[model samples]
Target: MKGGILLLRSIAVISSSVATIISTMLPLFLYVSTPNIELISIFILLIFSAFLIHGVLTHALNDYTDHLSGTDTNSPAILSGGSRVIQTEVFSVESLGRFGKWLSILLVMILLVFLMLGYYRLAVLLFVGLWAAVAYSVPPLRFSYRPFIGEWLCTFPSVLFLGFAGAWLALGSPPEWALQNAVINALICIAWVMVHHIPDLDADKNAVPPKRTSVVWAAEKFGLAWSRLPALTYYFLAFTCTAWLIPERFWAGAGVTIVTAVSALFIFKMNVADPVQVSSYEKIMLMLAILNAVWLGIFI
Candidate 1:
């Protein structure tokens, strides 16, 4: 039980669950017109399970990397120090590596089964998603160490692509409505990634190769200015996408948009007043994610 708890903490279970939920549900909500409720629920569960397993593998591998790199010392609460198992000596490095490798292989096999069931697009998408996960911290790419590329790759391929691919798999092909939702989803996803970095501002400064965005932004006023432009652009694109593609659900879409915009505004305002008070920003991100998923379900 103790070991199990360590594993769960290492994997950041709650965040991983939310990631799976967004990846699995957005696509279904957008593309599956007249969806069979029962079938959709099953697919969601399956996808969520797949993502959870992937997250576990990723967490293990990442922890191994951080241990090797000596970057896990004195990390922030939200920065995933990757020290849980390593610091506790619950698992040796060799054992953790073996676990990660086997877990990744198992995830691939499961994804292949989903593909054989006629979900061809999902199979292709899963490959890219897994690649991004590995590339984020692994050699030959280590893209996550880069600045802008890290942020966008983390946000787009992993989040946006998976969400879109899931929808395509469930619905065969996205309707204009689903496509519109995809745009909004992508924008929101980008924003979420940006805000997630705020919590890691300090640790990221000492990254070996040095992340450009983090360095530049940290020098600014509370890191708020760095994301302001992107955040505003995301909100604008979200509203425009919804307005153009979902005119029928205008009132609902507008309401959600307004709320999201306000939440963003509050985060910015609070950040400007006190950079230390960023818990509200995190809450706003969670709320936006939930509301975005709910709106897509209701409107699409």
Candidate 2:
């Protein structure tokens, strides 16, 4: 039973789940000056919970699908031995499938509650979110099998949807700042995904359903290596544009830009030398969260 619980927790991918929630909430924090604290708190909790459920369902479903497709068997040694839960018998295949279904259903129910509370936009977002989660791993529309599409899909929600949702929830409407910031966030998220893929190059190639980014990365390692540049450039450009256009908050924007630049440099160096290092990824992600929080504090 204890082992089962551990496996379930692993399926949840709690660190990634928390990062998603934080990314979503940070945008809201930045855009709203005096949002209703209690309501905002509840919404954050609900969204975080939804993401947790989504993560668990997505991982479990992916594991089940991989097993069926024999992708897990062909996975590289690094991924197969060190990372993959399903391949190692961390949980029974049947149990994982059951958990996946139940968790996905529970997430949908939670989204319905959001609709009941007049957060219709959030409800709609949840619908898309659920679809993305399932389609990424399942058959028929397994977008994850597609090269570039999978990476974009994986990162966009954290960057765009979460940021927009946060701003919308905070201000009760979408503003230019919200939209722009969301785009910047999305770029950053995409860059992060590209960097993370540097390590998974081998495993992704051998999988039954080959990943797009993996192929792309293999073909054009240099191009993929420089992928983070555009995102970093955008972050700085956005900050600069916002500062010049909205002079009152110029300092704040510039400050965030400086931090983003420094962080991007660190991330770029880490990716160049050791993409597979878990600590590097964690540190970069943590810095991103902090930078986002600071940006929100200044803007909202």
Candidate 3:
């Protein structure tokens, strides 16, 4: 029973749910200041659905596929490796794969629910999120095994949709401000995710099919010292967006700017050559990314 509990915890990866929570709450705060009981109840269900899609299904496929491709097997076993359930011997690869399949079915059921309710927009967004998670890790597409494509095609859109989720569900469409904020949040997310890839470079390269994340590709093309480029590039993009928005949303923009600047500095100073050190820094990066999301939700 104890082992089963720990295995479940490993795959849950609940710590990563901060982005979904913030994304859901942002629209609720902006659109439903005094939401009725029905709206609030629906909001709660929406949050659950988001978690089911992202935190559970996404991680399930990721952990299962990475294990199959040997990336997780060779992973540095820090923040970068897939969840450590398989490594810890609490779950088998087949079991994890089965879990992913079950979750996929569940996600489709939720998507159908939205469709039946005429929430076509929400259904489409959820479908996109599902596609990203599957195509990113599963066979055929396996975008996560390639550089740039994974983050840009998979991670970016999934997160952008998540940021737009609350507003879309509540207002039936996100306002300009919400859209801009969603873009910024997505940028910050991908930026930090790039950093998260740094420590896994060696493990990824050594994987069976070679998970050449953008960070790994940059390191090979430029040098390990330059692996920071991909993350820095995204962070700079996020910084530029926030800077552009400063004139309109002063406090919110300023909050993101300060946190982004600090995060970029950390990435700049990161010792990319040391997997252990880079792994340690990823926790801090994750914190800053969450802070950016929180600030956007509250102040925007």
Candidate 4:
């Protein structure tokens, strides 16, 4: 029982749920005004379905693939390594792979249910999540093994869709407010993830096949100091989005601006070689992101 619990928690399912749940719930709060039983039910289902695809399938596959590539084996970071289940011997590699495979089958079944029930948008969103997960870590098209391709092509779209999901489900089509929120959230998500990768730069480079994340690529091409470039570029982009929103939304925009500044500062202060400090900063940034998401929803 303890091992089972450990395995589940190690996957970071709850952590993954934070963005999607807030994204969905806030839109429901803003648009519905008073959510009916039907709305509540749909909300629950959407969140559950997203949990299946992202929290379960995506993390599971990523851990499995990273383990196979030996990245997790070499990782020194506290937070950015693949789930430490295989490293800790909580589960064997074969067992983790099977766990991911079964969860993927379950996700496909849920997708079919959405299609049959005329929830085409939900199906499409889930498919994006599924593709991002598989393509990110799987062979051949292993986007995460390359540089910018993984974050821009895989992580960005998946997170953007998740941000758009609540608004789409509530309003049929997302409003400008919702789209802007989604874009900001997606950009912030990318930013923090890049920070997460910073601590793993050396380990990623030394992986059997080389993880070659954006941070690693930047360090190799632009020099070690430039390793912070990928994450800073994204934080700047997220800040730019808030700047555009300030004219129409003073207080909310101001709130996000403060949070975004703090977030960027954490990255700026981060010692690229210090995994402990980077991990500490990563935790704070995550809290700030959740706060920013709530602030966005409240103003919406």
Q: Which is the leading candidate under TM-score? A: 4
Worst 10 residues of 4 by lDDT: 7-16
Clashes in model 1: which pairs? 27-167
Local accuracy of candidate 2 as per-residue lDDT tens digits, 143-246: 76676666466546644665556556556776665565555555544444455444545455566666545334444565645545434444455455455424
Q: Provide the overall lDDT of each model, using Cα atoms, as 2-decimal numbers.
A: 0.58, 0.56, 0.75, 0.78
**Model 2: lDDT to the true structure:** 0.56
What is candidate 4's lDDT per residue for 107-131, written digit by digit as tens? 7898899999998997898888888
On the 0 to 100 scale, the lDDT of residue 298 in model 3 is 72
Better lDDT candidate (2, 4): 4
Ranking of models by TM-score: 4, 3, 1, 2
lDDT at 200 for candidate 1? 51
Top candidate, metric lDDT: 4
Off by over 4 Å in 4: 1-17
**Model 1 TM-score (2 dp):** 0.75
**Clash numbers, per candidate:** 1, 3, 0, 0
Model 1 worst lDDT window (10 residues): 10-19
- Candidate 4 local Cα displacement, residue 278, angstroms: 0.9
lDDT of 3 by residue, 26-131 (tens): 6565656646665566557666665666766777788888887788888777667765777787778888789888878887898999999997987888898899
